[model samples]
Target chain A: MPDARSTPVTAAILVIGDEILSGRTKDKNIGYIAEYLTSSGIDLREVRVVPDVAEEIVAAVNALRARYTYLFTTGGIGPTHDDITADCVAQALGVGIDVDPRARAMLLERIKEADLNEARLRMARIPFGAELIENAVSKAPGFMIENVIVMAGVPAIMQSMLDAVAPRLRTGARVTAETIEAGNLPEGGYASDLALVAKAHPGVSIGSYPSMTPAGFRNQIVVRGRDGEAVAAARAAVEALVARLHAARG
Target chain B: MPDARSTPVTAAILVIGDEILSGRTKDKNIGYIAEYLTSSGIDLREVRVVPDVAEEIVAAVNALRARYTYLFTTGGIGPTHDDITADCVAQALGVGIDVDPRARAMLLERIKEADLNEARLRMARIPFGAELIENAVSKAPGFMIENVIVMAGVPAIMQSMLDAVAPRLRTGARVTAETIEAGNLPEGGYASDLALVAKAHPGVSIGSYPSMTPAGFRNQIVVRGRDGEAVAAARAAVEALVARLHAARG
Candidate 1:
């Protein structure tokens, strides 16, 4: 077991959008960010999707930012009346918000000053004492206040914002995983054996997932851990168990 | 504003899975249920996704089930060792779980008795005193305890389970909405006007979303409310604003 790090870096994602909660939009950002954070060695422990309501957003932001090493929020940062994530984040941190010069400069790169109306300027309103997270796709930069990092809800922009912020994030040991396909074998046939394997490889996290499609039930087992040695050992054990099951059936 | 229902019925979704958190699977259930619940007059207030940890599932269940009128959970009910949603749910409700004869009978309709191994039998486990939600896609049944409805993570199965449980839920007045597309008008160009419209339509929720595609930026404005009159009124105002912007450009 690799317990090298005394405290592992962790994060929680807060997806703020009424459209998402109302089911008008299928969220693509959560999976993208989750995979990115996992690969970057930041444990994405929790994700909460709240509507555009200010109170709900504030409460979630406060709770999540306090618990996780970092809090990443997507959505509600647009130039619309319902876009209140910036203000809600300010409320959560008890900081005043205004149109920051840095963010305004970035916005100007896309829109001329004459064309920058109130709605467009809303995107530039940054919380006090926050660092800008450059939006490479567009000019409206996301900002990081304390431990909370806010980004666009749109998949493409959110991906760019994540890439910009990832370099500065405090990361821990990345988890490594191995998968073993348990073709046609019912989980019931190998459930007990899998549990025993899990018990033996206490350091690795083992999971079995079954999907029933036109082809029928397809089962896959995965083992994950930070320690490469532990993951390899668990993979070997799982492979042996599956091989034994195959032999018994034959 | 339509205040037809004295208190609106609300719901929260608890998505439990390791594959989803690992980013290996893009969640399709949340959006499906969100749309389903919205049309059924159940306001989906919040959504939380957690890993396959027992304690995390228990905590999320306790928090969400306490706050919302209904708490729907998806995933972790399969016939695998990692499928602990049933047990964790029981722990959250302070109840015991066992293989229910009703669920087993349902399972037997599909699987032969000889093939019903321990793993397959695991799927029949339900929390004590809970009502079973039928899975039309498969024989495995989901159960509802108190306000919590547990279902399969697979999109097809989850939809069937939700359909089975929706009729029994205490739903409130359904929300109606209208959409206004601002094809080329920049949100910044009319942001102040949009805010004024939002203030006028306090009973309705107004939102603007801008997307930058290969063609260019496309903006969409949506107005939503439980009141037919209020929603219509907001829609008219948004249409007029977009029209005025068009005239100015001409």
Candidate 2:
């Protein structure tokens, strides 16, 4: 709790859409959000994908925002009838929502009058006391109420909106990563030795990712730590284990 | 609902772990589950990833299982202290759980006596009325109780278990997909025209995906339907629309 490794900023992602659930659309937002959050030094700790149901959306928003330092949501902010993220966010916060002048002004720039019907009007509503997160490509803006940042779910639009919002987030000390590729060893074979290395380096995180290569299944042990010295120490231990594994194989 | 679509078998995926949320792990499970369920003719209508918390997992299981035909969970069934999915699943169903004779018999095949301690005993706990799903790579068998299929979080193991389970599931009529790539067009520009096409194809689902190619941004229109003939008709209309778009650009 001493903030020695910088203030740890934890965040969550809420993806709302029926398309994702139906398998009609494969999600590309989670990866982009994860990469963006990591590079910005915010630890993204949780993500939930719920349907357009107002009750479910409200529940997820309340739960995630309470737990994480920042809650980022994508999807359900479109002009379609199924798009209900705006109203859901408003209800979750127990605040009145209407077409904010700032939001309406922004939408009017890209959308024509006839195109902007009552259905389109739904996208302009923001919770009271919320700050609009600018959408660069499309005029419809995402809004941030307290710790929750509500953004569009479309990958292109979401990326554009994230570009406009990421600069404003509070960042912690960046966690650096190093990987050691251990060839052709099943995770079970190295499980005991790896466990010992993990216990020794308490400050570092060691993850075993078994990947299928052209040669066959190769396990890559990744060591991550805020302290470079601890990470190096863990990496050395992993290398020694890998050498022993090779000798045993021979 | 009539049995016209072959009984509409529905399934939900519960992704467990803090790593996925923290962006340390980009989840490959949901996509694999979605694709696998669709291929097996099971309608995967929902997916949720909860943390290593008991209350959250119990609530999700209760809600999703009641609404869907089947529920599949990945992650948290490991030997570590954070691994608590098996116990939570048992608690959710209000069933008596201990190391089932069969489960213990299977685990004993691969793991040694010293390795299978009190901590590892947690993995062997199977709820009442549960049946084991075979894990070809490792001895830790996945369990199926009621409508929920508890599989490993690792992609390879999950895939193998899914392959084993697919044959046993009651399948509906297989849904078919068709794509019409619209080269270099923005989604908003063709919004009105696409709406007309969507209206025409009432039975088919038409989605416009905006993508970046070597030439720049392009829109790929996809048509999905249960009827092959209906999907082809929708695809033809989309192709015409894309052609008109190209001519207009020229």
Candidate 3:
């Protein structure tokens, strides 16, 4: 449906948990999801982490869903008192929630009927007209409502849920990137020139990351764009500039 | 400034980088900063990750600074082309940015005058009328403008910077927490009773975290509040509920 000069498909990740805000749990889901979406040709533009509060979740969900093509939320869907993500999501979408037959079927495959206490049944709750995202780690499945994909907070389970929903997403052109090692050259030596190159190749996003390596603080300049020619041209310009600066030092 | 009871001081962290958005670097600063601020009695309620764009940085700085008592930003402070956090911060605060004499003095503690090239000198730039947050790990310093504190992305350097600013912050009453181990009980088994416990102790924030340990999916309930007595009371109720459930199972 997009024209030749189509913009990239964008997504935002919302991480919901009190444990994370409290610094009790280090989140592993955001990075994993960012990498996965990037490889799948989706641009992850923004990420937010909020505590397990109903109003907070609803506000964030509404804001991000309206802004991006998709919004992925992790955590707070478990069978506990603090796991209010589902109810909050339902309220955000203005949809009534009940135990979905598909989700209950998935749970019944792993949990016996006699063992299906109210606690385990809590995982089976689904928003109106949502599709179930299968969880291979545990039988408790995640669900997708409209443009938002809700998944588990645990790394292993979220990965499985992501795999289940990947096929349904509308992908875009994969971004092409080229990295030029600036050796030991300080970024300040070529910052102005790099800016000129970036201006010249407006399509390519040129970035410089400095690391304190054994050789010293080495700068790595990266140029990324959907157009291969633009990315490659920017990379060549950066390399040429760096070579000039290094020679000037000699 | 307060007569008797004071409102809790809240904070937010803004993580800026293209590497994080592109999925090349997994973020380590948010968790470290979140935990550090929590122990200091500042509630880290929101966290956002945005790319190294000046507009994005300025927008986040403005939003977070206006909303929270303190806003901490990590990344984009290095001496590289993408390290525009200084300029962006100045713009956000509506101030001029130039090389700070104090920061230059700190850099001179390590590097000689002749060796201090423009790239290395980039680290000395600070917003107008801002306080420097010392980085003992490295010679480069971070800075604070108004309520927003800017620090490094590297864990060691950020930790040292946090220590420098920790003493200067207007911290509120420290949150006290009590944790009760739920043994091998599933959270679903006690979700309802836990909700009741939470309702009765409205002052305390009770949270349930489920993790797959060697024993299995064990629930760890944490009760947190500014009032130690309230936290302790809620924790006792959770413990009693777990003990009763265990006895019934036996």
User: Best candidate, TM-score-wise?
Assistant: 1
* Model 1: CA > 4 A from native: A1-4, B1-4
Query: What TM-score does chain B of candidate 2 reach?
Result: 0.94
> Which lDDT value does model 2 have at A235?
97
Q: Which candidate number maximizes DockQ?
A: 1
* C-alpha lDDT of residue A11 in model 1: 94
Indicate whether candidate 1 or candidate 3 has the larger lDDT: 1
- Residue B38's lDDT within candidate 1 is 91
Per-residue accuracy of model 1 over B1-250 as CA lDDT, tens digit each: 5454668999999999988888878899999999998998889999999999998999999999999999999999988788999999999999999999999999999889998888888999999999999989888999999999999998889989988988898888898978899988877787889999999999989888777778888888889888889999999999999999999999
User: What are the per-residue Cα lDDT tens digits for candidate 3 across B1-250?
Assistant: 8621267899999999988989878898888887888788889999999999999899999989999999999998877667889999999999999999999999889778887777778899999999999989778999998998999987778889999999999888888878899878877778888989999999999988877876667778899998888988888899999999999899
State the TM-score for model 3.
0.93
What TM-score does the predicted chain A of each candidate obtain versus native chain A?
Answer: 0.97, 0.94, 0.96
Estimate TM-scores for all models. Answer: 0.97, 0.77, 0.93
Give the DockQ of candidate 1.
Answer: 0.77
Report the lDDT tens digits of candidate 1 across residue range A131-223: 999998877989999999999988888999999999998888988978899988877789888999999999989998777768888788999
How would you encode candidate 2's per-residue C-alpha lDDT over B105-204 as one tens digit per residue? 7888887876576655666888888989888867688899999889988788888888887787777877787878777765555656777888888887
lDDT score for candidate 3 against the true structure: 0.88
lDDT of 3 by residue, A96-133 (tens): 99888889899899878987877678899999988999
Clashing pairs in 3: A119-B188
Could you tell me which 10 consecutive residues in candidate 2 chain B have the lowest summed lDDT? B208-217
